[model samples]
Target: MHTLIASPFLDDHLLLRPGSTQGLRIGERRFKELAAANSPCPPWLVDAVGRRWPDLQLAGRRVDEVVLVRQASPFGYGRASYELNLGCNYDCEHCYLALKKFDGLPWPDRKRLLHVMRDAGVLWLQLTGGEPLIDKLFPDVYRLAYELGMMISVSSNGSRLPNRSILDLLTTLRPYRLTISVYGATAESYDSLTRRPGSFAKFQRGLLAAHEAGLPLNLNLIVTQHNAHEHDAMIDMADRLGLPHHVFSNMSPTIYGGAESLPAQSREYLRKRKPFTGCNAGHTFFHVDPHGQASICKVGRDPQIPLLAEGVDGLARLRSIADKLLLRQGGCTGCGLQGTCGTCMPLVTLYRKANAPLASYCQHGPDRRDQQRR
Candidate 1:
């Protein structure tokens, strides 16, 4: 297995260690020079290899053996996320994907799509789904992406982490991070929130097994009415496991403009989000759904680039789409508080499309009140 990767990330070049967060930015000229050489790498890189990876030998090794160098790409895409399939085992009312369907591109098309992502200059890729591990082709998809030299991260509910095949595959390939969502600290709350009996048991077993395997892990505490009482207990759970955790209190509408998940919101935990400071969604990165539809981001899905139908050439028009979508228009017309808006325009647009109450996402929502009145 390669210990390091020297790849072009968007406009910049990066040297990253697989299965870990270690990374070093390399100058363009130095990277070009390294790529030109055949064997017996430079002193600084060799020394870095020694210090960075003490376990590996530092003999007459070629740069290719220690570091996999990627050629420069004309397209500027540093990262991307691919939803393998929308199928999931748990029925969480809080899920953003209200209509979770179990369908995706066939094996050939899936392989083609992965290649498209690899060719698009995606260095860091996220393999997501309604639940990625549950997908029948997950292992194959993951292995392909890993072999293509993309540092990967996965977002899952931790239900399948205990499966021996899944565990062994992960242990071997080793994703950079596994971000698991925790529904509740207790079985009752957990199963109730997921609406699936014995789900909490599977979740617990998976967590313990993954932890024991010494895999890098992250926890997302999904705060909802059913699980709110155990919020502190959830934090304690993460702490006890010695894993980093984040709390997601607010719920958003489904990608298809459904309000089913809005009822699961824990109003007490909802707080004003930070101001949107612009993003490089389409320019620097993009999102691809299971069927190979490319968009600027998950929130902005209109006018998608059908990667399979249009192929990689379709990406030539993505940056322009991103520019148009980023503009705060339509329902946001004549809005004065654009500067202090909490959510991005695309997300705000979804709420509008769903015909959801303005208070759910807007800064001037019903929740905001005068301090004197309180």
Candidate 2:
């Protein structure tokens, strides 16, 4: 039986299991409760409770109550998000990854990254890219992830897939998820977004191949101003293809390929399309640049603090660094959508720079007061 402790210092929504501690600091109320309460519940009961209520709304944000523990993983199963490739093959009019050039990691750095993930007790990883499959090094990286006992998940544009041999290798490697983005409903719409003439066919075949290979598939859809009207079509496509749609609006412009190519999203678009909760970038997850610089999230690149150094001590330093970096000092500071909107600090930086009002890149613009008066 695992004893669970509820912090009276914080709201009842947050709980701490005996072995599993809070990654972030608990509120004062939670701290007091934690101080007074000994282990009052077992792991089994806590797990049961989590199953009954998976998402706990705290501070107006939703987080998974139960963190799934990988039984065979001795390192305790850490979470990591790896930028596998930097180049995107598509040129969608509103493409995010396309704004940047694709840069593949050198073999040495790749190995070091794998070692770091292993040392940090990370068994699950999110492998993202402009288009991971576009790079030949992807298989090698995936192999390295498997060698290090990490369950890999690739977030791709569904543009390319591995051959049978590579697919077989991935099968043996056994990743946790392979998430692909489905951008449009029709070929015209898809190709228009991808900026490729025959890309829709290629992606369709890729999705089929992935499905045939028995890979667990998760589909992503960026609900944009241009595509929002076609939301039902996108959902139907996901359903027909037997994929779960993880839909969301645009991110901050800082994530755009470069500073020069930032796309603007309107505030109205944000209000209509975005979720109420803000982002979990620095709080729940951090971002690592190709140069090995780590920050709370990819939005704001603060060089003062990084998760790891060139070696082992780096891994041990991340959690503390993450703790210190809490409470971002940007767009979210006093924004109405602070907790609900998924905007990050970097996006805020770019947004403020582009428009003083901080109009969301994914939303519509607000009507000016002078115009209203006129």
Candidate 3:
């Protein structure tokens, strides 16, 4: 009797007897041959049957039934984001964390956490960071996840890919995707945003190197007032490289509840009209900080629950929170500007507590008010 195990990530089905590690990949013809006993049995198969079904030779003994079990996948939620580390090489001015200290989980604990996630049916993993590639354990962690049958995506700064060793490792692992942040199209504009002279050249070189290596790569254009003017050029650069790019203009306040680090124009940009629909954070997606603290998302990093301690049960608790959080509350519920409001409850709860001006995140800007006047 043979059991079949199927993998979503693999095209082949593995055929095995009960309690046997040795297996064969079989399609329709091989499966029928095995069932009908029409083909000669291989030595390995004979040995496996003998060892695993030793009791079957006894009188009145019958072959055990072959059981097939399909791999479990996450229910509705198929993706997860993990902040591999909080340490970064670049110190961008609009950084929400403001270059805070790196406090990632230890290597052993991180491995265990991945196991837990796999068991919970999370097959798609996003490994992000202050810059995931900068961490020394990145390669080992990535390999482990890949071996565990997870589709891995990386968020990086593109600074390290220029190195031959790193590029080779990336090419070998073949991550599902790599999203690199592009600050600017030129060295001066890019380095100025990163606050590291010559870093822009390193990024460009790394991007080109990755391209040459044939690794799947995408660009994330982080637009701040300082480099907003270079948006067109940045897109053109990605086009020239034949890579897809996404532009993000909204900037969050500092993680420490301060807006002091954001550029003036970035601060103003957040006040403009925006769609105010609630996010899908705790439901289909969640964020795990470097310290293994799980939250709804990066922007809504409050009420963090310890992920390793609670595991999937903690995710359930977060789902409850998300169910109750999908609406504008308090002053936002009845406000006439609700349609144009960009700020959500979580953002308001975090940033407004510091008494930072609400106007910075409100939709009642001068243009909106003037439109109302007319």
> Which is the leading candidate under TM-score?
1
Model 1: colliding residue pairs: none
Whole-model Cα lDDT per candidate? 0.87, 0.56, 0.70
Runs off by more than 4 Å, candidate 2: 1-77, 256-269, 272-284, 304-309, 315-346, 361-374
lDDT string for model 1 (29-53, tens) is 8788777878777787877766776
The window of 10 residues in a row where model 2 has the poorest summed lDDT is 61-70
lDDT score of residue 126 within candidate 3: 91
lDDT of 2 by residue, 276-300 (tens): 3444444435555655555555555
lDDT of 3 by residue, 1-374 (tens): 22322232223334543223344555555444444443345444445545655642322222223323235445345567888888899988877776657777889888888876666555568998888988888888887776665667889999999887778777776777888999888888888888899999889788889888888888998888877788889889889988999887777677667775545345433536467776677877777888888787776776788878887667777887765565677656656667667777777765665456666667575666676677
Can you rank all candidates by TM-score, best first? 1, 3, 2
The 10-residue segment of model 3 with minimum total lDDT is 58-67
Backbone clash count, each prediction separately: 0, 32, 0
Kindly give the stretch of ten consecutive residues in candidate 1 with the minimal lDDT sum. 365-374
TM-score, model 3 to reference: 0.75
